[model samples]
Target: MRNAEVARQLGVPPGTVSYWLHLDRSRRGECPGRRPPPPCPRCDDTPLDEAAYAYLLGLYLGDGHIIQHSRHRVPSLMITCSEKWPGLIDEAERAMRAVFPQNRTCRVRKTGALNVKVYSKHLWCLFPQHGEGRKHERHIALEPWQQAIVDRYPWGFIRGLIHSDGCRTTNWTTRIVAGERKRYEYPRYFFTNKSDDIRRLLTDTLDKVGVEWRVTRRGNDPYNVSVARREAVALMDRFIGPKL
Candidate 1:
């Protein structure tokens, strides 16, 4: 049966089915396209054929939590394999179609990082802009560590540079340690107050990477890319000492 039909029968979103199918793909030695056969749902451990597996993956890709926003629903397909498997992606696509004939718009992209592939669609939202003269909302107070990142890294590296009206909270602390998962948000301490924790983390990571940086508080305006670039060059000169 197609993914939608299976999802309707199962009383779940098509995307959820897709996620399970994807997980099943990982369990098997095969990439995505080479599904075994549909096992009995009652049995749980029964193998799945290519058609059955594709339907499940379609359900997952459609309903997975990987994307933050719910309005933008797009399916994706990723395939990895050993040897020069140039046909793997194609085979997977065909198999998926056998289950969900309606899913023709999902996008797939290949990355050079190992044998990984990513399938996703963009989600768009409408939000306000932040700048002078605009009514600004107070962002969450930054922890010491987050502040450190802002003080150390150049502004250009920070992702979310624009200001916008919204809620703020301490939950953002994770960004400094790992980084933001979303596309628009800054690294850490962009809108929030500076913290010592951020500074130490920034310094440590930069040190490990062999990049030298400095902190300067010129004004309330956070790190600006052009200004930071100029400052970085000067800092490098100071570090190496005057050239003889």
Candidate 2:
């Protein structure tokens, strides 16, 4: 099948299918316009034949899952905190393949970090049946309060409730942009939520910034909403109108 057709059927981009095919072709020693058979059955320590590998690779390319074994097939050689090694990745892949012939198809990739200095010396096998690349989700914009939480924590913060109510009307307003521009209906709403002790930290920080906020129930009931909460909702309606 053509790359685009295969990608459309598999729900991925055509470039991804082409990349995988290129990787497969590279592994078969057919990169410079040479046609070679599929990779060997035991090429990467997988207990499957060439046909099985082809079928499994197809399934993997088509969004199939790769099962991981509970135990490591070959024990990893642990190297201590020795600073003598520079090209550890190349050295490790060579040593591993010498010890286990099937590891020839495996590629050594780097990951993880140390205290101040980064550490990288992990080896992973690239089986044709299980080498599909990863997918990444796009970053999304966060609400004002969520942005506040992210700014304070740099990791993440939780929100129990967010109340936003606003009204829309057809009106023209002029504003100075690069020159001058007109805008339609504007949005006027407020956001508030309950959190644990961590929220108390956020609340104290937000108070200094004139955010007009308060905390009802703290750590007692994380998800529980009390009668006082309804009063807060009513207050929001009074301050920020009745349409949301």
Candidate 3:
């Protein structure tokens, strides 16, 4: 049937029906004019930057999402970065490009954040955690292969998480020293996520790296992982620093 007919019957836009038909033909190798998709690291054994992949994975768990619309030919990997930190947007784009060098990436401004996205059919293969419903509502676990990559580049993963949903802030208090009031400040790191599994990933990696962290409650929900120990904060400062 024609796309218009299908669109009318299904109550969808004609363009959507056309896109679906085009995607079906392309998948069957019937669309000779379509550009062939680039090789995938998971399926084609292509070389991948494990460190970058680890970092991208962290950002994904924290603030990233993949869209696979039935009417779209390819899925999009999107990581929402705050416009307040333009540098993070660039870094997120770099990470996406590094993970999929052959694909092009684009940024769409939305309210106060920029959605950094790249289109590729292999996004699901790279990010196996993509699924139905919100990430926090679903069971999230890393496959063995992804775990191996994170294990090798734990700091990179932590940095990615920090850049996405974590922050470095200073806490200050007043103290009496030699009959004079003195102000003292200490810096700490906080990683906040709604998903329990995502928070566990951060703390687990922190443990492997010998960085002490404690779970903190936001109101009634324990949704924050705090790294406030002097030694741990120093360690995090040395590696992750503040998001630019």
Candidate 4:
């Protein structure tokens, strides 16, 4: 289908209809002599380690992209982390290496950010989460084995979610104490994501850890999960920690 046809059918802009059409051209019964390309040299057959993979999967769902390489390109995995938290990027690199030790990992510089990228065809295992438009437009759920991994290392999963889509910071508000006006500050953790499934996963995991969180909307935007209050934040502090 053409870009304009897709845009009209899906009620989306033309630019949003990128790559799919371009890539599908190869699979549209194009030529009688065409053959599947040889396997990628960078691809690996590494076994999955549940705990580490759960953490990496959480990070991928939040900030990673598994690019499907074109006929002339190589498949690659990319995870973007904030430049402010070098540790988060380092852990991300570590997770990728742990998952795919045979592959080489590198960093790409983006404005105010750095991306951990690896060229490996094996990264296609994450294709389930890849889609058109944005994550909010797509539904994300864990596979049975992936969910089992998360069940064991829920905290690690939470860490990745908060590290990628959530933040820890101080929130201040003015209130009245004993009939007198006063101001106070508190440490809180806020997580925002367009995916309802991701939010539910975070909340369910938090519930398991006995850390309380609240859900609200920021204007007309996506759901915001708040781990405020001293008690709740304390629990998060012990388990989630800072992005670093």
Ranking by TM-score: 3, 4, 1, 2
- Candidate with top lDDT is 3
What TM-score does each of the candidates earn?
A: 0.21, 0.18, 0.86, 0.76
Local lDDT at 68 for model 3: 75
List ranges where model 3 is wrong by over 4 Å. Answer: 1-30, 178-181
Shift in Å, residue 128, candidate 2: 31
lDDT of 4: 0.79
* Model 4, residue 206: C-alpha shift (Å): 1.4
For candidate 1, the TM-score is: 0.21
Top candidate when judged by TM-score against the true structure: 3
Cα lDDT tens digits, model 3, 113-147, are 99999999888899999999998899999999999
Cα RMSD for candidates in order: 19.6, 23.3, 5.1, 10.7
Sort every candidate by lDDT, greatest first: 3, 4, 2, 1
* lDDT for each residue of candidate 1 in 203-227, tens digit (9 for 90 to 100): 4444553454555453964321221
Q: State the lDDT of candidate 4 residue by residue for 1-244, as single tens digits.
A: 7889989999998877876665575566454576544333224333565676778877887888777646636778788998999999999999888776666899999999998998765555544566666787878877675677788999889988888888998878999889998988889999988899889888988898788889878998658999887898998888777777
Worst 10 residues of 3 by lDDT: 27-36
